[model samples]
Target chain A: MRVGELSRRSGVPIPTIKYYLREGLLAPGVATAANQADYTEEHVRRLKLIRALIDVGRVSVAGAREVIDALSADGRDPLDLLGEAQYAIAPRHRPGRESPEWPAARERVVALVEARGWLVHPDSDVIDLVADALSAGDRLGVAEFFHNLEGYADAAVQVAAMEVRSVLARPDPAAQMELVVLGTVLGEALFSALRMLAHQHESARQLGFSPPTPADHGVNPAP
Target chain B: MRVGELSRRSGVPIPTIKYYLREGLLAPGVATAANQADYTEEHVRRLKLIRALIDVGRVSVAGAREVIDALSADGRDPLDLLGEAQYAIAPRHRPGRESPEWPAARERVVALVEARGWLVHPDSDVIDLVADALSAGDRLGVAEFFHNLEGYADAAVQVAAMEVRSVLARPDPAAQMELVVLGTVLGEALFSALRMLAHQHESARQLGFSPPTPADHGVNPAP
Candidate 1:
């Protein structure tokens, strides 16, 4: 198929496809002539995946590149694909003073995470990462809050892992790989949006607040 | 009090306090001399809130600024705060593709969302946004997978909204607000992780596959 047909079929435009090819986001099509290139089913599939990462998953071009690389990596475990992608996009920390209470709080989190059977790498920064979030909390009712959150993260890890693996079990490697990305990437945004709404509604009922109006941000503002 | 003392009191470090002031993330302390500034309780409170945004909320400085502006906006309703924050972080759209199917899909979604009693904007984009996701999903065995997801999103919105407003109903508005940010932001991550695992597990059973190995992002070659 010509690039035009590829664009029409994949819904990705010619210019964006050109950019993706130049940026190594997509591999080059076979050159039938000096200015003609032929695409294939794989191209269509890859293009759709790229579209999914960008449009639905909200990943940056760089982030999407990393995800696609991991996804298509030969013999790469899905778990590692997810991890590599996460590590790449993980927020960079500004080095600073560590709180004296940080270690103890970290221990508490470690214990909680372990008890919940999460696979925390021996050197995974998530321990310190979470502890920093806790310490940064400064007794603003976050210690207990994190305590609950740690448990939630544990349960979440289990649930998401299971869901993704189930999809990976599909006989079609294509579908399996497709779900792997969906369950991990786009799935995050979907559930995040859901959790935000869920927590808000629950909080409203318990707090006896009036039905939500448009002006709440003025009173509550972003944290 | 000195910055060190305020650090101890607020659980924010001296350097972070400096960073905050320099960034205008926090208001400056009362000036005692050319090189001296005295910290106050307001500094303590602001410091904690900033930490919440950075660490627990995992919001970037620019995003934090948006939240802060909304929060500081005088005479705004709380509901607006939530909506505005969502707007800031709402999903992005593609450059051009007028697929009529998206609006129809979105209408179904809106009906589902409204049935759950969410305060949704009467905008059409949300439909397009969701249709994009469903369209990208080629492997979700069920034809009405988008509808299923809408149900999920609707339920999530209701639950999250309730949970958040419950905090606002607390006796202390500050604590309520703090918890709201913590719950919504952190809860977003946790819930998504859970959904990922759950969906994987269900998909596996239906596909007749073995359970996935434990969650390790970096590991052995694919099994």
Candidate 2:
């Protein structure tokens, strides 16, 4: 298939596909003539994955490249590959400050980790994220948000355990790495969305408001 | 007592403070004289909140203005104000495509809600989010990711219930509104970081790798 068919099938524009080819995000198709190349099913699959990462996962082109490289790298530990993908997509945290509240917030995070008895690297990216959020919560005078950390952690660990278990069930290392990346990135989006819905439901119940149903949207039932 | 003092105290630059002032995100300090205005403790507090929203919550200036307005609005129901904040911060989902997978994904979300006995509106922003994620997961060929939706939903509802209970405990409507906005935005970041840590711990245990401890980073122990 030519780039035109690939673009049509993948819902990506030909120029974007050519750009991806230029950027080495997509492999070159076999040259059938001087000005034409033939793409295969593998190219189609790769293009879809690239589109998914950029569009749905919101990963940068460089990040997507790193992810694709990790997926294709051979002889690397699956765990390390997963780490690379996770680190690539993880949100960058601002550097820590020397403010008094900063230290207190760091202490709170350490306390929560100890109480939870979870083994995580002290300098892990998550440590910074947790500390930053706690510090911001303190500054905002939202003590109650921090109070719910334990409940949130409890729920977090449950989902995390499930994710690890499911990903490990895959016997193929490459498949495992792909699942880890996709699950970690897209899964966050999914969980955040679900959390929002849950909030809506709980708030509606508390406020005595009936939530809109599918019927309200005219979503027809299956006949 | 002045804008300069407010800047010094809040660690936000004067120009940025002025920008916020221009944007109506921060209320003006009382005018003491021509070209001189006296800022109060309220100004300092509001400045800190604005910084936190911009830095940690990643709320845009416009979004922050909406949030602040929601907070200061008079005689509005606290829940309604919270709804505004949540809506403002809710992650925008891409419009659904007219494809078989899209409708099937929507049906999956609807079924999940019914099975869980959740009271969320079918037309809620979260519905599109869940459906879109499911469709993406399906397209990415990761069936196991969707398999864990039930667990994610269970955990989400627990956290959401705790959030509602905590916010409702605040008697002041403005404070309640503030908590809702802060929690809805920053809380997602916090939970996501925690989830990453949890994943690391669970994966390390499964893979028989020892995770780095606080001692590895020379983090001082509490005396």
Candidate 3:
């Protein structure tokens, strides 16, 4: 298929596909003739993955490229490649003097890790992210929320264990890589949306606001 | 304090502060002269909140203004205010024909909600978000992960319930609003980071890989 067909098939615009080709984010298609090339199914799949990373994960083009490269690397440990890919696309989090309570927040994170007997790197960027988020909670006057970290950690580890097991069950390395990317990015999205809905339910329950069923509200049944 | 001091105090630029004022996202300072206005500590707090919404939450100026206004509305229900604010900052997700598997995915989400006995509105945008994300998984060849939605829902509800409780416990409506916004945005970040760490631990445990200790790895001790 030509670039036009690839765009039509993948829902990406022709110019954007051309730009990706020019930037070497997408591999060169087979040169069928001068100034024309034939793309295959792999190109369509790659294009979709690229869009997912950039549009959904909000990763920069360069960051997406790096993640793609990491995924494509041969004969490497799956765990390392996945870690690098997940870290590459993760939002950068930095704690500063603005959150004076960050020190206690950091201790809480450390304590949670120790209590959980988890095998995570002591200095991982995620530690700082978790600490910083808790620190921000303190800054915002939700100091009581810190006491619930154990509950959050329990749920996180439970769901994450399930996700990891699914990724490892993939028959091929390529499938495993796809699962890692999707689970890391889209899984967070899935869980966040669920949390939002859950919060809505909890809020309604606490306030005695009955949820209007779709049948009563004339809401569309299909999404 | 003036705009310059507000900038220095909140780490927002003077021009950006003026821009927020011009856009009515931030309340204007008291006029002391034609060219000067006095800002209070409330201005400093409001500036930080604005930055948190824009910078951390990645909310548009217009969206932030709506959320701020909703927060300030007198005699309104906190539950409704929080729902509006969270829904406002949430990333817009529209499922399209490209995700052909969305119908089945939507059914799975409906089933999960029913099974959990959750009281969320049946037609909430989050229902579509969860369906769309799951549909993407189906498109990407990770259909087996859908079977794990129950576990994910379990965790989401557990944490979200705690968060809503914390918000409701706030002594003032203003504090309740702050917790709602902060919990919705930073809480997601916090949980995502925690999930990433949990994935790392699970991967390491499954592969028999030892997590590097900070002391031996020369990792920074402080975040």
Say which candidate scores most in DockQ.
3
Instruction: Kindly indicate the candidate among 2 and 3 with the higher DockQ.
Output: 3
lDDT of 2 by residue, B1-223 (tens): 9888888988889999889888888888889999888888888777877777777766678878777887788998554665677666654447335656888888889888777656665666668777888888877778677797889899989988898888888997766776787788778878887888788778876876654454463222223
Write one digit per residue (lDDT tens) for candidate 3, span A49-130.
8887876677889888888888788888766787788778886545353566887888788777866667766677677778
lDDT of 3: 0.78
Candidate 1: lDDT of B159? 45
Candidate 1 on B144-167: residue-level lDDT in tens? 223346445644554454455445
Q: Candidate 1 chain A: worst 10 consecutive residues by lDDT? A: A214-223
Off by over 4 Å in 3: A93-104, A209-223, B93-98, B210-223
Q: Which regions of candidate 2 are displaced past 4 Å?
A: A93-98, A114-119, A207-223, B93-99, B208-223
Error of 2 at A51 (Å): 3.1
Cα lDDT tens digits, model 3, B43-90, are 887877777776667678888888888887888866567668877888
Pick by lDDT: 2 or 3, better one: 3
Model 2 lDDT, residue B11, Cα? 85
CAPRI quality band, candidate 1: acceptable
Put the candidates in DockQ order, highest first.
3, 2, 1
How many clashing residue pairs, candidate 3? 0
lDDT of the candidates, in the order given: 0.57, 0.77, 0.78
Clashing pairs in 3: none
